[model samples]
Target: MGDVEIRPARSEEYAAAGEVTVRAYDVDGHLAGDVGYDTVLRDVARRAEQAEVLVAVDGAGEVVGTVTVVLPGSDFAEISRPGELEFRMLAVAPTARGRGIGEALTKAVLDRARTLGIPKVVLSSLEGMRGAHRLYERLGFARLPERDWRPFPHISLIAYQIDV
Candidate 1:
């Protein structure tokens, strides 16, 4: 959060934000296989319409990171319950790694939930995303093994939660 601004994404920055997301995931090998997940990842404008899309903009006005906050009623609320908030699609540009942008984006989501009086936050991550898992753990989110599930034949998602 230092020199970077974390706020709702402006319409004009949607394309940049989307590319950051796609690049982050692709660089991490999260998109090695096959489907059209990148298509969804690149649809920042649609995500902004359905949920709160937050972007981390660097001092030079570049989108360095992005995440989507899914409230209970939003279609993006995959594992979110009535009183819980869920954050999804957290991505920091490959060039921005180690700058704490991902952690800042996550904390911003937690702050949003607290502001809305939500008590808990939940999220699902691809099983191989160890870096993201470590971040969530450092933020006090615990694994909810019972809630883990497979959304597609080849895709397994693990669940994590924290009380805000």
Candidate 2:
């Protein structure tokens, strides 16, 4: 409840970070109870080995949020292109919403992009996630409908991009 810090998730914190991810998605009805994607979210360890897993910890040291940042060509890079860094699985624990943890975690990724001299950052979000969309907009991300796509018939992903 004091201050939250966003940083890379340690190997031992991967499972907990994954749990945060699923809980956030479930509360939003994005992929609640979907074992396939839930398992994917919980596999932060695999993500850490491939991309980067960032976690938000409360002043008390509890893991309250997580997001996965993918390099341009990583397997997790769904919508990122050259000179861009893409992030996904941005989730704040349901109990932790409205605490600015989500913003902080997102800003962390943006900050990294700046440091790496990346020209832009992009991501895909499920439709109807108004709160998340608001956050993206507030951070200067613009809708990239031209890039919005559906990987599967049942799942729609809207794209957003911000020049860093």
Model 2 Cα lDDT, one tens digit per residue, 1-164: 35888889988888789899888888889885344898888899899989989999888888899999999889899999999999999999999998888889899999999999998999999987889999999999999999999888788899999998
Off by over 4 Å in 2: 32-35
Clashes of each: 0, 0
Candidate with maximal TM-score: 1
Model 2, residue pairs in steric clash: none
Lowest lDDT 10-residue stretch of candidate 1:
72-81
Poorest 10 consecutive residues by lDDT, candidate 2: 26-35
Off by over 4 Å in 1: none
Top of the candidates by lDDT: 1
Candidate 1 structure, TM-score to reference: 0.98
